[model samples]
Target chain A: MNILEVDRVSKQYSGHKALDNVSLSVPEGSVYGLLGPNGAGKTTLIRIINHITAPDSGSVTFDGHALTEADMPHIGYLPEERGLYKKMTVGEQAVFFARLKGLSRSEATVRLREWFDRFGISDWWGRKVEELSKGMAQKVQFIVTVLHRPKLLIFDEPFSGFDPINANLLRDEILRLRDEGSTIIFSTHNMSSVEEICDHITLINRSRNILSGRVDELRSRWADGHYSITFSDADPVTLMEALAPMAGSFSTSADTRGRHTLDLRLLPGATLRDVIARANEASTIHAVNEAVASMNDIFISAVKANGGDTPAPVIS
Target chain B: MSKVSIIIGREYAERVKKKSFIFTTILMPLFMLALMAVPALIVAMGGTETRTVTVVDPDGVVAPQLVDTDNVKFVIATAGTDTVAASADDDATLLFIPQGIVEGDKPLRLVTGKAASMMLENEISSQIERIVEGERMKLYDIDVKSIMAAVESNLSVNTVRTDRDTVGSSTMSYALGFILTFLLYMMLLLYGQMVMTSIIEEKNNRVLEVIVSSVKPTRLMLGKIAGIGLVAVTQIVIWGVLIVGLSAAVMPALLPADVAADITAMNSGAGTLAQSNLDTDLLSALALIADPMYILGIFGILLLFLIGGFLLYAAIYAAIGSAVDNIQDASQLQTVAVLPIILGIVFGMMAATDPVSNISVWTSIIPFTSPMVMMSRIPYGIPTWQIVTSLVVLYATFAACVWVAAKIYRVGIFMYGKKPTFKELIRWARYK
Candidate 1:
């Protein structure tokens, strides 16, 4: 079921379109990834969904109802620019924010304690926000965003300040929230995190949606259908000559330790078995593995295919 | 149930809990006591008996009648040319009564260290006159005591006026007026800034966004103004209570009995003056408080003006806070908000010089200035109709300010990055 629908929302600042005819929907109980390069209008879309700025022309629907000012209470938004009162204590600030989100003081206190203890920062209750580290403050903000258990949660660059360990911890909590039936919309440049947690993805470029699908579907769509084959005693000259006509595409190189390895790029409508059968005919294959495209490769390919002039990979 | 109440509660709780509040609450009364006590202590320590002055009569013919008394210690210096310098440093006024003078023509000269005091001069002059009269009486063979007693004293002058009622000195009126105006002006300024700073802090921290999501902008705005206003009111009340309670408790013991009685008489006299001008006294038309009605009236009008004026100005402050992304940007707009308050204070203070003058009337009637001006005039006496008109205009002005402020608020709160100018604010007001 569609929990949020942003239809053709356009925003222009002095004739420069920040968002142009951008339309997307998030399925219920799904971790939707909004993927974009820098300045791809991802933040603009998020701001529109958060009702921070009105679209020039578009309508938003939440839970099958037209969105109104009253719907703000049911949606939690954590902006990329983290804001917390520096002079206020963590506990006081949390309760104040929670109360604004419609939690009573007592309820906020109870929930805040649980979240604080779960995050292992219960001792930070009395500390001012400025006194906390970047990651610690982010943790507090994350807890605040989710404290009231909003039906829809929007997190922008949620893990930007976290170390790997804390990043993994937050990632787990985000997945847990998705599992518990909360629709999540997250926008990030982190392809790895998107690969790890996102179920469905939408890529926006230049104020427009360029590509969107289930993460696996997008990966599969961009897959080259190639396989990597390694053989103990395979001669590269013989293998290349034997498979040259039927290889579709093939390249042989030595591994780091100088062992024989062959990489093949398959043509469209070709199968990995065709290349494997040709390589096996030349020599006995020790190992054969079909390559699956990672989110990074797919992202780069998508960005590149859309006339993006990024630099090729450079070896360090 | 109202959002304003919630805001008020929050503001009261957060502000009253601060250490500064408690500290100021206790410190002010002690400071006031010290101000009153130190002067009295100095005066008491300085009081002493009057100093004595001696007169030396040099002429031997008239020296037999030189009466020495406790207040006047007289020593006769013989009539000689060498005795003048010796008597100059003797802490005495040397009176040289010329020898061989007629009974009625006894001439005298006075000598002292530097200059004799007026008291010493007068005493010496009177004593010389008495000697001359005594000589005249001896020549006529009449009793000198009866002749001296028959001299008439200077006539006294009394004044009576019929055109105007006697009022207290303009100094007291001006003092009360200045004080009342300043108190209102300062409280408004202090709390208005407090409101602005609080809003800016909240906005900077992004807490305002969260708060506004649940509460309407109007409610939130009203709540903030109300909350900070309550805090201001609480502080003022605490200060007032401390001053009044402390004075009532310590004034009797602190002041001398005669001085205290005089002060009480002055207070009662001022009250009677206020009563004498009943038609002009604004307090007489209003419900009288148990305390001095004029003071109560002044305070009541002050509260109304402050609450109304603060709400009006604070809303603008909140709008300014919302419009700017940083404190530096807010400072530029602060001048716009602070200028009217400064004008009110300056003009209101001016009212103290001439409470019944035309300038005071104009200022008191002006809504932008009436809060301070009318407060200043309350001590002297203001007409009921003028008070009502001032209040009506002030309330109307407050409402108008709030409307304009809310317009700015709606646009400014969400605005970031761009600093808006006056033109832009007007444009934003017209945005939808």
Candidate 2:
């Protein structure tokens, strides 16, 4: 069910390997987060997939066909470095871009009007792009990106210039696009949103794909098999005291909320069932859940493990 | 519409609505009309300055012939000062005629507050010459008509082509050629800079990235180029219609009949081309224009070369635009394109006087200069092979230049902030 697949793609530019042996498969009807630190070659892979630049080696298949110029109409890409013709009116520029993406004149106008009204920017139809504020202009560009309603939508740093309210609005729209069966690929440093919306992700670092999988799988893969237990039995210390015997082999902490958490290092024979069974002997187990890492933690840890030279971008 | 066509339409439609385009389209023709009409108006209105000359005829022989003219009035002074004063009582000239003037020992003297203009001096001298000649004739009793009829002979050279066609006036040919050549040159500068600046502006504005991702780079550049070319052509046609309309109808109406006749005489031949004989020069120029082949050939070559030359230069201009981050970075390479067009203009102007010179012959055939130089030569009747060769060279150069430029432009649009050098552009062109 992959809508787009880029495999073993390598691209070189003036002695720099912009993308090297990168592979990614975006599932249909899912939001795919393309994650990377600065200069991680995410944009390069996006460009290759979009056919903006050709890969030195490897191939990209879109909707079961090799990506080609003919496929451009089916792929909508909103580049990170994007702008509109400033002298052109907002609606005029939007319609022109939609037309470039293979929309008919009447079709482009109709579709663009829908998007403009949805974004509450119908009044900006006759206003030039220069007259719009930065966020307003970005809204115009975002509408343009999705106006053609291609099967595969790619957005690079789409939320960079939007306020939280508009960002959430765009986030809702992006999820809606996914729900409607359009595959989405967007690259950003915002991990919380990535976790919030993305079902799958491909993490690229240092011109290579470091890790990629379903978001839940990736977050759990980076997780330590530790559990935080909250029990309201006769005492929560009973749970801590139960782990006190294996204190030399495990770590334990008790929060003020009578929740006991234990960091367990697995022995060859030890299992989560054993730990739970041991805890049950001392107290009634109210809740037992394994701790999982957030996407931000996984991103930083994965980048750190792979080459680890690049500074981890601060999550805002 | 196809993507390229859509892009072309957008490029054309968006700019055509701009205030700058409308202002230029309307203003340039007016400027051209003013250029052609202002001088003619001044000459027509300059007829009202009249001056009076007082003649002090100490000698009786000079009094009877003193006459008035349109701009000069002569008042015969029966009694006058013995000496001509350094300054006149008014701005008019005062002449003191002494007895020595009838003899060969004295010169006719004129006195005025302001120094005499050569024009006034010539008029006064001619008046004196007429009087002196009359006096001399009366003294010798010789009739002036017999002298002119006896010795003056009219002779003219009529050049007929081997095909039994009469050659037109060389001056008129030069004027027409120079004007057409200048028009080509100006069109190149105007349209060439427009294409270049438009590209740079798009690049700087970063709008190129979105458009290029959707449209092919070559189509985008060509679309923009063609769009601006259409605008340029629209402007030129409008100006052409306006200027031609003004020259053919309005100018004649505004001018006095005699002055208009003078202009027509001057435009044609036989009125005052330093060889006036039955207006043959003017007639031939008019005839050359009237000849279908002449009209077809001049415009044919002009159209061919205009497209060829502009395409060739626009490729270079677009490349220069792409090679930089903005107009400031483009300044250095801009001179490279402009200097050649200028050299072509110089060769075009030089070709009018010395069409057969090595410079004209070479520049007329070179692609960069061919549009202007060949335009000048075509009006003067160039050889068929030369025009064909220049056209071929121009078209070939245009194809090659666009090919190279498209390569650079594709790479340039993706680039940011770097001020690329010529060598870098060459390398970019070399890249896949």
Candidate 3:
């Protein structure tokens, strides 16, 4: 089930359109990735979903109904630029956010204490935010973001400042939240992490959604019809000559042990069996594997293929 | 609890718990007490010293009539006493009336060991001049007593308002009006800037987005202003209770019993100050201060204007703060909010001088200047309808300002990096 759907959302600032007819759906119990280069309107779309800003045109549906003020508590957002009142203590700041999310003071206090203990940050609870290390503050903000257990959680650039250990911790928590049936909209430029956790993604560029789908589906959809093959006791010349007519392109290289590997793309109407049958006539096959595109390659090629002329949205 | 109240609670608690708030609350009354007590202390310490003036009149014409005061003693010098020697005493001054000085061109010569004070000079010169003039009048065979009576009969105007039970001095009213106006002006500026600074801090901290996502920007902005306002009111109330209580305990101790009774009688509108032997100006001032209704009226007008004026200006200030990334960038935008407050003070001064004049009346009725202008006029007993009209306009304008400010603030807080111009702020306000 789709927990949130944005349809034809459009937002215009003074000089430019931040989002142009951008649309996406966040499915329940899945981690949805919002992929875009900086200034590609990912943040704008996130803001619109958070209701921090209104879309110039379009509608947002949350949990089977049009978005309203009452729906705010059901959504949690941690913006890219994390901040807390410097003079406020960590526990007080967290509880304040909880109260703002409609928790009673006692409930907030109890939940905050549990969260603080779980995060191993109870010792830092009474310390002011200004006194906390950057990583520590980010952890506190993370706790504040998920403390209410909102049905939908949006995290923008969630790993920008984390060290490897903490980043892994954050990733684990995010996946855990999804496992518990909370839909998540995660926006970031880190494609590897997206591949690791994101089930679905929408790539936005030039204020428009250029590409979107399930991560595995997109990888397969953009895959070239190429296979990497290794042969033993095979003559490179004979193998190339036999596969040349059936293959679109072919290359061969030898390692230090003098074992040669052949990489080739099949021509139209040629099947894997036909190519393998033809290659077997010339050599003994050792191993054969198909090559699929990584998300990084897809992202670069998709943005570049679209002309890449979209100047970054003026943030101010 | 409502979200706004939660915000308000945090805003208030954070500020009230600060050391600065506590210091300002306790120390402001002490500061004011020091200011009030310094002059009285100086007067009490300096009142006892008496100086003798030796009069060396060659003709002995003006020497007999020169009288002594509590601080100045007039002593007729013996004939053949050296004027310079007689003036050698540290506390004595020698006055020489030349022979035939009543009819001659020689000015009265005063010789003192040190330079005499202006007050002593005026006393001796005036005494000699009066006697000299009387001698001249006798030379003309004129009726000096009848002329003196005629001059003394010149009328002194005593203003009595038909609505007021006792006669009040216009100068006192102007002074009181000016004081109240100045207080409101200061509070509006101070508290309004406070609102702006707090907004800028939240914006700079980048916490505004997190909070705004939970509640409407309007509610957050208003909650902050209200919370700080409660802090301001708390400070004022503490200062008020301290000052009023101190003055109540101190006033009777400072005044003679009879004079205190007269002030109490005048406070009740029973004793006429015109019949008192005391300085009527001082007595009336005391009486006015003693009147509970008058002080309450002043306080009521003050608090009303303070809150109204603060909300009006603070709204604009909040908008300005949200439009910029930092306080440095806010400086230029703040002028728009500051200019009207400054203009209000100018209008207030005008109202103090002439509350009934067209400029004062119009400015007091206009919302932009009414908080200041109306505060200055209220002490002079302006028409009830004008007060109602002014207050209504002030609050209505405040509501409108908050509405527009919230619109601008809602958009401006999300914008980063560039400082928006006023035109941009207006555009932001127009965004749906």
Candidate 4:
């Protein structure tokens, strides 16, 4: 069952359309990824869902009912801009926010403490929010957001300020939430994080959804049947010469271990087996790995194909 | 938690805990004490030394009658090269009584270091005239007995008013009325701004979003107002108790023996006045507040006016906070809100000088300005109808402001990035 359905929602600001007939859905118990570059209307859509702003057209349905003001308490929204009263203590702010989300004081405190302990931040409860580091503040925000356990959770760039370890911890928690039957709509530009956590992805460009599908399906659909080969004593000239006829493009570089390696992007209808055979004919193939396009690659290709210039991908 | 209570509690706690609250609450009384004691101390240090005025009576008629007193020593100088300026420099005020031939044409000149104060000059002139009149009566061989009889035969009239209450007035009543009106006005303004500024700060910091999501906007706004209002009330109660308590505890120790005697004498005089003019029930009521019923009356009127006026202005402040996204924007609106309060205070001060005057009546009737004006008039004995009408209007204005404020609040809290002008706020009020 679909927990949330945003159908052809459009929001205009003066002459500029922030969200142009953008439609998306989150199935029950799924982690949905909203993928877009900067200023691609993801925040606008999230804000619309949160009822901070109204859509210029179309409607949103929650749990098979049309969205209304009453539905606000049932949805938890973690806005991109993290705001907390600097002078208020962590526990106070958390409980205050939780209560707004419909939790009683005792209930909010209990849930907040449990989350605080889980996040290893029980010591921070008495400290002012301004005294916390960005990641610590984000942890408090996360606890507040989930304290009431809303059926649907919307997070916009939730992992932006988290360290890698904390980021992984948040990822695990998000997955756990999904497993516990919470539908999640997360908007982020971190395609790798999306690739790891998102079950479904939507790529919005120029205020419109240009491509969206299951993450794996989208990756597969954008795959070019490429394979990378690594071998000791591999001569780049010989490998290139043997694969020239079948290879659409190829680059050779030495790996960190000083082993010779070759990367190839095959032409359309080319098979991974055909590249492997060509590489095997020239060099002693120590490793033959089929290269599947990462979400980053698919995102770039989708964006590029939809008339957006794909910048050089940065690998971390 | 109930929304309003929670809001009120938060507002109460947050404001009372602030350092500013603690500072003001403690400092105000100390300042007031210094204000009251400084003049009396200066006078005491100056001492009761008399200045000798040598009157050069060339006519020789008025000299013997002008007797010396502790406040002013009169010396009769008989034309022995009188250095008028030198004598004035030594003491001050050398009166020169010219040789007067006629009874009605007596003239005198005075010399002093700097110019003699108007009060001193008037005193000297009156003394000279009394002396000259006595001499003229003696020159006509009019016996003192016959003069006394003739003066006694002249009609002595008593004044009575039918429409006005004959409470008779005092300097203390006027002072009390001014103080009560001023204190209430200051507290309302000082604390109302505090509430408004706190809301604006929270909104600017974006913390209001979190708070508003949990508590309804109305609840949160009211809670803050109530919380701060409670804090203000607490401070006032403490100050009142402290002032009365401290004064009672320290006043006897601070007063000199002579001053205390004078105060006792004054109290006896007041007792006689009270016995003659005030009814027994009114006297008992006056005794309850240490025989300052006018002070208590002014205080009661001030309390009503303060609460009504503060709530009315506070509602406007809350509306301003909601309508504007930042403190800067709210500041622009603050001018308009403060104008009426300022006008009330200024006019109230002026009304204190003449509480029964026409201007005071008009000021007390206008709802916006009435709190201060009515408080000032209470000591001068306002009509019961006027107080009732002022209260009714103030309460109605407060309710209307709250209603309008709620509308602005609902719309304004969600608005960001842009500030609406006065015209825009009017439009927002009319928004469907």
Work out the TM-score per prediction: 0.74, 0.84, 0.87, 0.70
User: At residue A246, what lDDT does model 4 achieve?
Assistant: 72
Interface root-mean-square deviation (Å) of every model:
3.2, 1.2, 1.0, 3.1
Q: Report the lDDT tens digits of candidate 1 across residue range B268-316.
A: 4343323232222222211121124344556667677767777767777
* Reference-based TM-score, model 1: 0.74
Candidate 3 docks at the CAPRI level of medium
lDDT of 4 by residue, A224-252 (tens): 46777897666787878877777756778
Chain A only TM-scores, each candidate in turn: 0.91, 0.86, 0.89, 0.89
Task: Please provide, for model 3 over B174-204, each residue's C-alpha lDDT reduced to its tens digit, 9 standing for 90 to 100.
Answer: 8778987888888888989999998988988
Quality of candidate 2 docking, DockQ: 0.60
For every candidate in turn, the CA RMSD to the true structure comes to 8.6, 5.5, 4.4, 7.6
User: By summed lDDT, which 10 consecutive residues of candidate 4 chain A come out lowest?
Assistant: A307-316
Angstrom error of the Cα, residue B300, model 4: value is 4.6
Regions of candidate 2 where Cα sits further than 4 Å from its true position? A227-289, B33-46, B59-70, B79-122, B125-164, B251-300
Off by over 4 Å in 3: A228-265, A271-289, A310-316, B30-48, B51-66, B74-156
lDDT of 4 at A314: 34
Q: Of the candidates shown, which would achieve the greatest lDDT relative to the real structure?
A: 3
Task: Please rank every candidate by DockQ, starting with the best.
Answer: 3, 2, 1, 4
Tens digits of per-residue lDDT for model 4, B279-386:
333232222223233334445566677778878888888889888777777777888789988999888988888887788888888888898888777765667998
Clashing pairs in 3: none
Please give, for residues A240-300, the per-residue lDDT of candidate 1 as tens digits. Answer: 7766665546777777664677876666665667777777777778788776787777777
Model 2 chain B: weakest 10-residue lDDT segment is B269-278
Q: TM-score of model 4, chain A?
A: 0.89
